[model samples]
Target: MTSPLTRNEQNSKSRAQTFGIRPDLFQAAQDHMVKKSDLDELSENLANAGVRGFTAATLPQNIHLGSPDSGTADYAILPFTDRYGPAVAAHPEPPSLQIEESGLWTVTLNLGTAGHGLAPAGSGFFEVSIYVGPEQPAGGPVRQYDFFNWRVELDHQQSFATTFTVDFVVESPGDFIYVQVSGMRGRAIEGDYTRTRLSVRKTDNRTR
Candidate 1:
């Protein structure tokens, strides 16, 4: 039997034919890669926004805003598509008021863990102040021009989970819109407090 060629020789012979090389094909490949990279970058940016975006499920405590204290930027909730009429999941929510604000639409809020000692059945209760303010243009101070806020009590029944949903619809339009979902709990499992926050964004009107 003939002896097998050495690995080095085999590699050299293989290297002699870099067959997949055509100027047009190479250019097309590069263009495709570039397009794909751009798309990837765009997708990542949106994901980052949602991951860190403000809503009702994320709002924290004390942060207040607006005239007459109409709506509070407390906590932000996701899957907003499931909010409003015909919820996919039967939302066992507390008594919610039909909210109406002005100037800004598409409100956003954020929530976070505040202290230790988790709340019972995640059903602690307290009064919260919600707001939706306008974003400062490019470089400016935090302004509440055309903003509104209000106070309401929020009850949680989502035990063994981080947070729950409390979505709303903007009955009007304006700027710097955000949401806040906060209140006092009867002390969670000694150091397990939930903190929430709010921020706002604009989107095409598709009420859920």
Candidate 2:
């Protein structure tokens, strides 16, 4: 079956006639917006059209960043899976993307409160970077994964959570892609994380 994005692109004019310009343009009028599931499906369709497919790994836990010495925050790799848990029965290793064919992949990182804990002191500016290399960096020169510039800064009092997503293109197989997160605050407002995940969805060259 043709993908919705493909269908939408092909039938833009028809959609415009009914949507008043484009489906996206009507979002505000209709009080709606593009959902993650919609993008996920589109990304999946793009991946299946050329590459093997897409995959996502997540760690359901509360972690901290920019704590103790907030001035010089340390970056932490977002966990993909629980090393010790029932999930290990299904996911033996950390959730990872093993690119079979180099192509663009969408990566999303979401962070939220798990329980009552510290929120940022005032406002928080967090920078999350995606990286790929022979080995995980250890305070050394490392290859920065050049994807969309995905960064999020928010006033802690304004919101309790944030999500950063971007499309990244890879050209080879066996390359490891991961996320590192750091915050501007000296110490992260400590709290339980309600949502924390690193998702990757591959797309076809048509996305170019």
Candidate 3:
């Protein structure tokens, strides 16, 4: 004849069965059987594995181009229309990326444009530049042009459709990244209803 199981033993078995954990291996039975230690371990492992996150922003239609008198280097607010329609017209609030993870992050700047016919037939030229800096204030001096920048050019012969791209790495957390469009000339950008986009994300070199 076998003796019936005690109340404590019954509850332990019940919790283990419900949680799909072995009763013999499940040690935390009192004051909640779910182990906090196990959860903490899982989270730590995930962080060490280098989980990645990213965000993207698109140029707004009819972006304010600084007057030609101000020159391309002058400060001009480039509005951005989010993935959807509406518009993010607020100043200093243009699309930006807030880094939270410390790893190798990449920023890809893309611009698409069409000839504005500003120049004579077969004589047009379009130029645009992207600038990036670390935690740069809304209005900072252009003397710090060394952060990172790239310029794309299209002449009458190459004016149909143009896309420019630039890639670089960010190695610290709490670092903020933004874009500035400059050195634009010749024809206007193509996306009037929509506009170019900038994307920032993390990448693991070991996996490459």
Per-residue error (Å), model 1, residue 44 = 22
What TM-score do all the candidates reach, one by one?
A: 0.24, 0.53, 0.51
Clashes of each: 75, 11, 0
* Residue 166, model 2, lDDT: 74
Question: Which should have the higher lDDT, number 1 or number 2?
Answer: 2
**What is the TM-score (0 to 1) of candidate 1?**
0.24
**How high is the lDDT of residue 98 in model 1?**
19
> What's model 2's overall lDDT?
0.53
Residue 96 in candidate 2 has what lDDT?
42
lDDT against true structure, model 3 = 0.50
Best by lDDT: 2
lDDT of 1 by residue, 1-208 (tens): 9999986666556554535445455566666665867889999977654322222222113322122323222232211121232221122121111122321234433333332233333434432233333442322224543434444333443322233223344434333333223444422211112333232332324344
Winner of 1 and 3 under TM-score: 3
Cα lDDT tens digits, model 2, 4-87, are: 667656557567565556665564555666788899999998765763345555565555654543445456666566332222
Which regions of candidate 3 are displaced past 4 Å?
1-51, 64-77, 81-95, 120-128, 137-146, 156-167, 184-186, 192-195, 204-208
> lDDT of each model, Cα atoms only?
0.34, 0.53, 0.50
In model 2, which runs have C-alpha deviations exceeding 4 angstroms? 1-52, 68-72, 82-96, 113-120, 138-141, 145-149, 156-158, 184-194, 205-208
